[model samples]
Target: EIEAVAASNRVEVKPIVMCRVTQVYETGACVYVYYGVNFFGVDDPLQLFFSIEQACVEVMLRHGAALSHHHGIGKHRKKWLPHVISTPSLRMIQGIKHAIDPTNVFATNNIIDT
Candidate 1:
């Protein structure tokens, strides 16, 4: 995936199969994990603010595969929902929800914020 990005794909186009690593495998099975850490430093807090938010949301999304088959659609990734998910996929699956309810009044547990 990183290689594809370096090749100037603009957006991450790889279809990733992610699973949190809780147990080690004894056979030839492969474990695909997005190992991440929330790093905070006292330096340049103003800049760190956005970076921290982005990283935090990403971690949460990665933790909950129920939100997305590959990764949870955290708020930070919402903006790119269009990119990661195909337009047709979005329209076919999500368009109705947003159209009939722009206020997102039906959203119960999902993150819906300004």
Candidate 2:
């Protein structure tokens, strides 16, 4: 069992790095790392890494656990069909992308303006 240390009135928390392995990678415009420390359903047999931006976004939106252990929203996993470009924040993002790219080279879905 782990012992607790006390302060004025609250117990001081000590961080424990409960991990086995970690690796890092870098690509065109991004760098990513994989931590092999995990629990059930996270069948990470190999410690791997990817530096692709698309891959990073893909994993986060798809496999990586979210607020309530939900799936993805991209072409791979979640595959959500966004009919409407809802919200002012999203509109702002579209506007910004259009302002920068304007040619729609990195165009995918949802953000049609880009």
Candidate 3:
């Protein structure tokens, strides 16, 4: 799905799967996906990168995969946090952030929009 998304945007990606960190469960296994893209001739590579990343996330969510495995969410994935978390839970997180950093001086907009 990720490769197809990249291909649709005219970008060829080389995917490297590392099963060493995979977690086995009663139902199935979770494999980590890492890929590299060649942006030698692409204009606005950053935009293209974001487009592919967002598309991949959407595909993963559609297939019942977590938004992230080990790597936590950052500004790039924050927008999708609501999809995985309940609204009240999200509000609680925001409240916690406010309590800890009322002035919003620490990692503003890193996870939730606090």
Candidate 4:
């Protein structure tokens, strides 16, 4: 599904599966996908990367996959946090961030806006 999404956007990706990092459960399994995109002849490579990544994330979410696993959600994925976490939960996280770093000194804009 992720590969299809990337291809639909005219992006070519080489996906490598990290089997050792995969987690298995009775209900389902979580596999880590490490992919490299070919940006040859692209004008705005960064924008293209973001577009493919966002589309892949949406596909994962639609298929009942978590927003993130061991890897934390950084600024790149913060915009979609609300879709995975509840409103109150997001508020609690923001409040915690405000409490710890009132001036937004630590990892500014890494996760939540606060």
Q: Which candidate number would show the highest lDDT if scored against the true structure?
A: 3
In model 1, which regions exceed 4 Å deviation?
Answer: 1-19, 22-41, 52-71, 99-103, 108-114
**Which window of ten consecutive residues has the lowest lDDT sum in model 3?**
12-21
lDDT of 1: 0.46
Residue ranges of candidate 4 with Cα displaced over 4 Å: 1-21, 25-28
What's the true lDDT of residue 45 in model 1? 41
Across 19-103, the per-residue lDDT of candidate 3 in tens digits comes to 3447888876767766667765667678877887887788777887777766777778888888888999989988898889888
Residue 18 in model 4: lDDT: 38
Candidate number of the best TM-score: 3
Error of 1 at 94 (Å): 3.1
lDDT of each residue in 3-113, candidate 1, tens digit only = 222223222233233456444456423334452222232345444445544554455457542224445665645664654556788776665676677788875324344
Q: List the residue pairs that clash in candidate 4.
A: none
> Ranking by lDDT, best first?
3, 4, 1, 2
Tens digits of per-residue lDDT for model 4, 2-46 = 456456556655533333447788987777656666766556778
Candidate 2 lDDT by residue in tens digits, 1-114:
011111111324431323222333362222233322222232331221121223444454474322112232343322222322246765687688788877767745535522
* TM-score of each model, paired residue for residue: 0.38, 0.27, 0.76, 0.74
Per-candidate Cα lDDT values, in order, are 0.46, 0.36, 0.73, 0.73
Q: Enumerate residue pairs that collide in model 3.
A: none
